[model samples]
Target chain A: MKTAQKNPPAHSVHSVHKTPTNPPDILAPVREMIQACIQCGTCTGSCPNAFAMDISPRGMWRMVIMGEDESITEELFNTKTFSLCSSCYTCTLRCPRGLPLTDAIQALKRIQTRHYPEKAKKNIHFYASFLESVRRHGRVRETEFMTLFFLSMKNPFLPFSFAPLAIRLMAKGKVKPGFPSAGNGALDPIFQKARELEASS
Target chain B: MKNFTHRYFYYPGCSLEGTAKEYDISTRSLMAALEIELTDIPDWNCCGASAAAAQGELLSLALPALNLAKAEAAAQASKSTAAWDILSPCSACYLNLKRAEAETARNPALRARVNAVLAEKDLQYKGGVQSRHLLDVLAKDIGASRVGHAVTNPLSGLQVAPYYGCQCLRPYAVFDDPEIPGTMNPLIRAAGAHVFPWNLSARCCGAAHMNTHPEVGISLVTDILKAAKGADLLVTVCPMCQINLEAYQNRASRLAEEDLHISVLYLPQLLGLAAGIAEEKLGLALNLAAEKDFRFETINEPI
Candidate 1:
């Protein structure tokens, strides 16, 4: 029932400059997938976290399909609508257009990270810390990953917010205390090759 | 001598080693009791989870591709001509692996790109390995009747709610009805527990949002917990759902202004108990809510 804001906030990330008229190449697949959207609003209706989103899923799609002014796309990116998606795929399942709505939302997140890392700073730090853990160790060590994330945030107070849960989990032996190590380093070659490929492409 | 009926390459993702260790323990114990042989995918790495997608589609695909390629190589090395199945207990890991399998199978261009990255590790995923969730294998491959036959202690009188969460069901409706998943219903019944009717089975548990955005995550958890108030325990197939539902009860209670305390357990842990595998083996003590909120004695009757 929440309504989308018509205009971007004055202090929004891209308020200084208009976004490019054409969407990024990364969004081409998503654009093709959603071009058939009839704006039935089924995605918005089925979304569990739509209330938390600034713009409804339907509204985001409408902007993409309409390919209107640069400001509209700027407003679309400015909103945390795609980031709020839980990847539940409910919206994708219910979309009458059979569009990959969830994947499109995820692509929005990728686009945010690729084109606007400054705007997606917090999300970038969070996911980077997680993947860094995986890259270092063959698997993610939760404590190590959380510590890296907290350190990356540079927010000294942030650790306290999660301290109670961490303490409880540690006390229950759910999480073991350990320093991060070069766990087998088996995945290093793959990660190196992937980075090389991505950079080249 | 026990005759093993089925063999699979087990991929216990990162969470299974830490927060959701109990899930791994219970699953291994339960599967062993059912005469299922699980071989760990040799040198398997992280699935990149929901995070890697932010880096790039290639990294996300490549991360799981490494695991899938490893499984395929392991299968070939063992000289097993039959196709291999990589069984992931964590829903996130299953989804990532399955996505890699499905994407690479249909898109040869993508397959080449992913295999190009895999060539670094001297691995090439040929797309024969099947990525499966434990629920899918249990519901379809190992039917409820077989599970029932293994139960030494019936979980009679226990009211249980099956929580499918997301990932496993959506966008892939592989085995069960995505919206109204009944795959776990027969499994729950097989353990001799009454299926507590609830509509929030396929609902989202907010996944990693609990860490990134606690307010949104706690609100969703509160709603799901509120809906599951009547059930004695909520059973989940996803490690993320299990942790989010079990870990945030106090916060969810405060947010909702109600004492929302429900024992949330992995489905395998529940079945492990019914199969009369020792509670210690099932890692029951590791569960945050199970110790304080759930009582095993209430349903500890031999059928």
Candidate 2:
């Protein structure tokens, strides 16, 4: 019996309560939800992008709970972290507290990027490349987005890498080289609107 | 005083004005027949769509906020004795306007900045008006009971996967379930069609991704269509999703090496079809339909 004494029954260590210092003016709906969170970890368990997030959804909200606004704000646009959220609402539905976690994250991201202009420019290359395709053709042709994305990234071998798959898909009538098909001639005004918005922005 | 049959502000935004002309046409026609009235927001700009939001969050909100403030002011200018609500046909427009409205209601600091930008346009948001997507308006305002009464033609054999897409149910669950939504399903069934249980119904249509990463987008789309297998069509409430899923299906299907190409129809178009409206009137010809393996023209219509 003495030889089998299991190391004092292994003491349980509780985690610290880290709350976020959020701005007072954030949406009341989101604020109420964030405040009511009991750190149940249910949200963390349900988040599809949990592994992708630097501060997982639950972790981000925990920061929000402790009033760590800046930390969560920084996490929001850290595209690799929050941008891929998919807004699937898995975390929202699973939370026993009924926290509007998805909406709260959306509010935070909007507030940060709206107040700070340069932060939004980070995804310029991706969007600009895509828009350039739309601007050239009336609509967004898949072949164009691919070519532009690779070109912008300067990955010369990208198209070649996709060639085998493209050819295979093309043989199956899956790859429509000339997309947009100039359907009913509706692409012109779409381009005009794009240009206007671009100029105004 | 009497309750009006139909009255709401209409914000078509950029897409319906151009690429999604059918969405605009059908919305106008259906609203008219339903006795619902829509007030157009004059000189409305794009709701920042995939481009601006992807650029910066502030600009994203600001752009759409400009349009919202304009709508609010238009409502203020209206002498009508009813509540002013802005109805958006395009899903992107609906999401953008709704996102800005939700954020402005939440963040006073951000609201102040939006106001600073609005000052340039001399417009302001008093938060009196609400922005809603067409599906939301249908499920809530129109009521499924009313829709059920209007089904002149029932689609007995049409198995529809009610695809809500990302913008309609996501970034905010304004008027529908975010996960496993049923707003359109009830309406679809009421219009006399079968609602297929599709897991990817609310998934992203790879919106801007189709233009940013074709391979990645094709995969995203293939996953959605695959989950929606056994459906005659993938019905959507978003113009962007409709365009992405329908216009790019052949390409996406080819890459998938599976017969994942499914016809994508707008909800209004489906309803119009069920209402005994012709294809040209419902904007059917506007869609990029895959060559169907079978036709059901002779199938008995339900009522």
Candidate 3:
């Protein structure tokens, strides 16, 4: 009888170091996380918005584990999955392998936001609006931020859907406009420094 | 009625000022009624919520670190005779501060980076502080028996489904089982209220997505309301969950094709009701669905 063929090492295929142009190092932080993914479809199954995502959590894992950074970012930039995450962390807790899926997704968001802002327009603009609000006043002014977000994301009508609730809130003496000058002196510089560090790093 | 007393440094995140004002009002009223003294950390800023972390890891760590630094300074300035635990009514603030504390402790490199950024503002984050959800404080620290004894106005008539949205129970929910949290159950029962159990208690309520993707958020909330089938109302810990569940009720009712008539109450608002605080003081009018479904009376508010 012929001897049975032995299985090769898991990383044997991806072991060769690719150049920086491939964005391999961009995902260096979650390299181990990607590899540890058993592809059990546990994450995809747990994700509430899996049906809406262009690339399911399972698909992201498969590509990332194989070091397919191009495909990963393409789907990330093209899809609204990360923004839909909500940081609920249900998948992280449910993962049998305990992969930090939430962090990995956030990492993907950070990379795309920093390097490819144009492609990641919807989510990136949302993040920018939030940061701008905080950076401007040391605290987020929700109405300002929401308005700016919708306008910047080119989805101004989005806020109109919830306008009735906003009206109710306004009537109830909630929805306080004009942010009090709380963190102006203390937090503005810190925010500027953070932006500087984020850009440099 | 028994007076359960404790001291906590309060961190009312930005949401308290705008969207979830009633949560803040109810938290204050409930804590005051419990004889729990709360010291607001002066010069507190945003916890960065979901936005900062998504932008940069350093920014995420740094933003909450600034709050911690401020909390530390306040505690030291007051020299208060209480354990310096920072109490955050906002689950997002609690999680962010807790995560900042953990990150600064574990990653020295990140801590150094954060401190360097903080140094510019004359702030420093020396990690050892504990960030606690007010619910955890009420349930674990104060104990259910005390809360039970303090219930002058038992919520016997009200059926409340305790909802633990992501922050207070996930990533690092130490008080109870993250999967099937029991912290709120005993407390809910302490107030003589019944719990409508369902798997979605610890599930995501499609949080900030209510703004970005309202459709998805509405659908998720519709599922929650569906799960909360026979309950009189859905009671929650996080502001975002409360707003999502409350604000989208009409839309959800239409979408689900079922007359989903349950109201959403902040846990504190429900507790305040049980404590006999006046409905106005508890800001009961602000809860959208609750205003529609239940009528509140000016209960016996003892001076």
Quick one: best TM-score, which candidate? Answer: 1
i-RMS of candidate 2: 9.6
Report the lDDT tens digits of candidate 2 across residue range A90-176. Answer: 677668987777667666555544555466443455665555554454344556555666766676765674575455444434335
**What is candidate 1's lDDT per residue for B1-303, written digit by digit as tens?**
243344599999988988888999999999999888899998788999998987788999999998999998888889865557989999999999999999999999999999999998888999868899999999988889999999999989889999999999978889989899999999999999999998999999999889887889988999999999879899999889998998877777778887778788899999988999998899988887784436423321111
Winner on lDDT between 1 and 3 is: 1
Winning model by lDDT: 1
lDDT of 1 by residue, A1-201 (tens): 233376656447344444655544455556777888998899889988888988898898987764445556667788888888999999888877778888777778987787778877778999998888888887888888888888899999998988888888898787877766666666788788888988887
Model 3 Cα lDDT, one tens digit per residue, B1-303: 434334578999998888889989999998888777888877788888888887878888888999889888777777655558889988889999999998788989888899988998888988745788988898888878877877998988677788898888878857878888888888889888888767789888888777667778888988988998877888888888888887776677789897676667898888888888999898887777774435322221110
Q: Chain B alone, TM-score of each model?
A: 0.95, 0.90, 0.93
Error of 1 at A30 (Å): 3.4
Q: Rank the candidate models, highest DockQ first.
A: 3, 1, 2
**Which residue window of length 10 is worst by lDDT in model 3 chain B?**
B294-303
Interface RMSD, every prediction, one decimal place = 5.5, 9.6, 5.7
The alpha-carbon interface RMSD of model 1 comes to 5.5
- Tens digits of per-residue lDDT for model 2, B1-303: 125544688988656754566777778777765667788887666565665554445666776787788888877777666778889987777877887888899989778767766665567776777788899888998877776766788887778888887667765777877777888878888888788876777776666555444555666777787787788888877777876776665565567776666677788877776666766676665555523432323322110
Who wins the DockQ comparison? 3
Indicate the docking level reached by candidate 3.
Answer: medium
Query: If scored against the real structure, what TM-score would every candidate get?
Result: 0.91, 0.68, 0.90
Residue-level lDDT of model 3, residues A1-201, one tens digit each, is 233336555556455545556654566666665667888999989898876777888877776665455665465456666657888888998999988898888887887777678876766777778877888787888777767777786765676666776667777777754433333544677877887886787
